[model samples]
Target: MSAFEVTQPEIHTRPIAQTELWELVMEAADYRCHCTGGLCGSQHSKTGLRCPAVHDQTHRKGKGLVRLVAAPADLGLSDLAAVELPVDQLQAWCPSCYTAARNRAREADANARRIADGPEGTLF
Candidate 1:
């Protein structure tokens, strides 16, 4: 039995309205993850050349099954916000890459805010 023959993957829970957008992004991505070393912290084996993982396929590194998502290329957006974007604004992402990228983006934003606010609790 194939993986698809089993129940739906956790990554595939996008609402029905989003399915068309998802397909558009996936197709543009050639059904492969677009992550380079920048986001996924990948080794570049699945790295610089573009991730080899395909939709509904086993991951190259055996981390888990590969389930790509159509999300905003800009990791700065919250998941809720990203989901609300149109298909043209989205990019194909594997879950691992997405999580790492989102975390990094949020941290960067926080750091920028921290810098702008100056040292915490400082009156000067």
Candidate 2:
């Protein structure tokens, strides 16, 4: 992934120290995309393409690609001060991977809505 510099915390919900958290995440991921087995990552090269894009802490709603969002872990924590999560919970995904993931989620949502709406009927 591209080199990312967190000059300031992006969280605006509450006042919490995110610089350290961001650093920890970056260090844990070795400043690289956490994508594995070529599932989703940079498509720049034929082999071992490491995207140089800013990473995001992506979260998927379900296994069916319902929704994917990027935000600080404290978003769900009632007590923002006690925001702590495992590296796995907050994976570092490159821009490409993140986009792909979001697209998949969008597609899934659209498909679900279409199915729910069912076939359109002609008006007499």
Task: Give the number of the best model, judged by TM-score.
Answer: 1
Taking all chains together, each candidate's TM-score versus the true structure is 0.74, 0.41
Model 1: lDDT equals 0.76
Residue-level lDDT of model 2, residues 1-124, one tens digit each, is 4478546666322114555555566666655555444334235364356543433333232223112223232222333432456544565555456556546555667788877788668442
Q: All predictions: root-mean-square deviation over Cα?
A: 6.6, 12.7
Instruction: Show how many residue pairs clash in every candidate, following the order shown.
Output: 1, 4
lDDT of 1 by residue, 1-124 (tens): 8866877555543436667778778879888887776666665563455666678888877877787877788888877887678778888888887888778888999998888989778786
Stretches of model 1 off by over 4 angstroms after superposition? 1-17, 43-47, 119-124
Residue 69's lDDT within candidate 1 is: 77
RMSD (CA, Å), candidate 1 to true, equals 6.6
> What does the lDDT come to for candidate 2?
0.47
